[model samples]
Target chain A: MLPAAALLLVFLTYPLGLGVWLGFTDARIGRPGIFIGIENYEYLWSDAVFWLSVFNTLLYTISASILKFALGLWLALILNQNLPFKSFFRAIVLLPWVVPTVLSAIAFWWIYDSQFSILSWALQQMGLIDHRINFLGDPENARASVIAANVWRGIPFVAITLLAGLQTIPQSLYEAATLDGASRWQLFRYVTLPLLTPIIAITMTFSVLFTFTDFQLIYVLTRGGPVNATHLMATLSFQRGISGGQLGEGAAIAVAMIPFLLAAILFSYFGLQRRKWQQGGGD
Target chain B: MASVAIDEVYKSFGAVEILHGVSVNIEDGEFVTLVGPSGCGKSTLLRMIAGLEKISRGQIAIGERVVNNVAPKERDVAMVFQNYALYPHMTVAENMAFSLMLKGVSKPESDAGVRRAAEILGLVPLLARYPRQLSGGQRQRVAMGRAIVRDPAVFLFDEPLSNLDAKLRVQMRAEIKELHQRLKTTTVYVTHDQIEAMTMADKIVVMHDGIVEQIGPPLELYDRPNNLFVASFIGSPAMNLLRGEIATGGSPSFRGAGGISVPLASALSIPNGEPVVLGIRPEHLRLSDDQGIPVIVAVVEPTGSEVQLIGRTAGGEEIVANFRERHSFTPGETIRLTAEPSLIHLFHGETGQRFQTRTDQ
Candidate 1:
């Protein structure tokens, strides 16, 4: 017990205490200064660019999470079918998620680039646009592209989670539904969807958290570019502290995410509690 | 409500055949039970009738229409699974109303149907509860209600009472039989429990491996089983089989394993020296001190209502006799037990087929 307590103090408490201290003081990578009293937080509140980054993070997180969930459920259902070589198809479907995110993000960056991009080349060929489309160069398209990338990278996790839930459901339930004259759509609506709600909810919570704090994919793909259209709080924090030399303001901006994170945690708890009451209380 | 006719149907999975060419005529409003041990193709045959599995060959007609290619939803049949596959998400009322809703019945009519079925099953109080909230017996009732509300042409049950406790199984068995009597719907029930078949079935089809061993009324099969399998499978303690060869002379007899001669009915056409197996039910064996084959009493078991005596012949083969009261014999005591000649069954050893007896008395 003594050794475990010492390790926790050395590893967990030390890092958390250091971060909180840095949040208050104007501490940079190579230089440090005395603690500032709420000065950085004041700047964090007044900065329109910082607030825009927050909004972008929420927008990207919500859209990507919902799209991923829907596509994941669809993929799970398809994979669950009694098709030939089902495991092989399921493995192939997991390729996007299994590949390293940074590499896939870089690949997507090339595909969405202004010139010599396959997407632009195809659009030009199709005559949807007569000229090459500069997808990442525009703010709207950049945000959408980033959200799409996140969704692609995250969908397999959701699908695999819900697939496990689906597998636990007895095939007899569907047989009973068939005997009740339920159509294919009715079976999914009344049987599959209700049974999968808990799995989907848990997956959504994790997806929201991961997407909200997303950093690597955005950094590799857009670098929070196109007038900060694709910028998230994580990327903006990095830019403010490491690039703009506003270490105190960046720490304040990073700390500002605490309230939103806490709110998400509370929401997830309440949702799970409600689900518990609806399904059955406790184990 | 409808008759189901299975005509020479066969089913196989990949390279393994599970059901052989089998045929049975199920009359409308008849409660027929397909009974056999596990993996005897009973459930598979039921599923084929329900349009859940395609027949490898042959035809199944429900209510005069060949439903060989009909989808399960279009078959107009309701099935109650062994596990009582009630939807966990829906209330009992919703579960019962689901089939009517699918048929596009108006909400009020469907609700009334659900309520009527629930009331009949004594589940009106549980209509608002989800399946998980109900007990096993209650869930089973809900499953039956779900089927009842549909009022399909036929009710198919795939060992629906197997998951219940012994007491509950007996209770549900009577309930199901009564339900069948009240509804007067054609039903095909599948179970491995012989007691269930004997009690509930208007006709019982006993299957073994992948073939139908016999099909008849419960008493008909019990009193006159066509083959050794049916004889062994139909009874609770199971018929005792003793192997021997046919003996010739003034009084023809069956020579058991230890050269003990047991008299057979003279009407039986048993060739001399041909190997034959003799079958006798336990209840038919009487223990008396009369002139009969000597048996060594090996064990005695007394239930509250009856006593069961386990004995061995001088040749060291075992046989059982169920008595009406506690037996006064010790384990080592030698007793003489008589096998009534009329109750003895003779089967051809090579083919395991029962040889019909011709009596002119």
Candidate 2:
């Protein structure tokens, strides 16, 4: 316990305190400046790009989380069935989640290449379009592309976690439900959904929190491109503090994401507690 | 309640068959039990009747319809699983009303069904609580309540009392029998316990190695078992069997392995020196004076009412006897035991089938 506390203090609490301190100073890339209270936050409040990044973060987190949940639950349900080659398929389904996000985003970047994209080439050859599709050049397309990429990368995590939760439910419950005259859809709605709610809450919360502050995928794919249309708070913070030489403003932007993360974590915590209480409590 | 017919049903998984051409006719409101040791295919037969398992061949009919291809829900049968299979998320009332709600019953009707079942199972006080909050016996009643709410054509029990403790098992056993009497449902219960079958079943189907060995009322199976398996499987303390031969001369008698001559039925028509196995219940053998089989007492256990003595015959064959009159016999002390000729069971040595005894006794 002492070791864990020490590690968390050294790696987590100290860095968080340092970031907050940095946010209050006029720190630059190489040299530290005098303390400037609320200056960076005041500038960020009126900065149109910062507000746009916040909007982008919200849009990306919400859409990507929803899509990830839908697709991942579908995959989990499919995996949950009694099919041949089951373990092999489970291993294959988890590959996207296991691989590094940046590497997959690099692959996506190639797939969405403006001039030599395979998607555009396939569409062109099919005679469905006359011009090459600019997947990342347009603002809306870039936002869609990054969110889609995030969903694709996040799906396996959600699916695997939800699959584990799905397995913990006894087969007898399904048998009982079947004997209760429940149709397939009603069984899913009444039995599977309610039983899966706690895990779904947890997995989607982590998905939302991660997608909200996601950086590597956006950095590799669009780099907040198409006129800052896909700049998540994380990517914008990295660009401002590390590359744009405004460490104080970047730290401020990074620190601003705490409230949303805390909200997601708290939602998951309460969901789990409710689950415990529903399971008859400590008695 | 509807009658259930399981005719020549077979269940196979891959290349291995678990139930082989089993058939049993359950009358309406009859409580039939399938009793055997583990891996005896009793539970599988019950599952097949419940439509949980597909019958590999032959037909199963509930009331009039052949429900071989019917889904579990369409079969109108409810099962009480060994683990109770209660939904952890739902409250007790919700769990009991789940089936009625699935049938699109009105909310009031569903609540009424659940309330009636709860009242019947003594679960009225626990109606709002979850299953996990209840004790084992209460959970067991809730499982029954879930089945009771359905008003099913038949009730299937798969070793439902095996999970409870000893005293609780006996209590639940009586409760389940009483429930069957009260509801008068056509019930098919599966258990590996012979005593439960004897107590609860109107007709007990004794199965061994996937085939029905014998089907009869409990006492009939106990008194006149057709095969060696049935004779040995029924009854607590089990009937003691000894290999012997029928004496060829007049005043025919059974000359057992240890030179113990037990009086055979007076009206007998059997060849001389015919090898046979003699079966005697522990309670049937009693202490006698001089003219009886000599035994060396090995151990004595008194279960309050009756004294069970484990002894060996002069030939070193183990025999268990339950004596009504208690005696303090030391472990190696010699004693004599005898049984009435009517209490003796004779079986063919080669075939393990019961030998036809003299009728005019």
Best candidate according to lDDT:
2
The TM-scores of all predictions, comma-separated, are 0.95, 0.97
lDDT score, residue B37, model 1? 92
Q: Deviation in angstroms for B13 in model 2? A: 1.0
Number of the top-ranking candidate, with DockQ as the measure: 1
True contacts kept of 1: 0.59
lDDT by residue (A159-248, candidate 2, tens digit) is 999999999888888888899898899889988999899889888878887888799999999999889998999999999999999899
What do the candidate models score in CA lDDT, each in turn?
0.87, 0.90
In model 2, how large is the Cα lDDT of residue A166? 96
Candidate 1, residues A135-200, lDDT tens digits: the string is: 888999899999988999999988888888899788999998887778899999888998887777
Give the CAPRI class of candidate 2: medium
Model 2 spans with C-alpha error above 4 angstroms: A281-283, B359-361
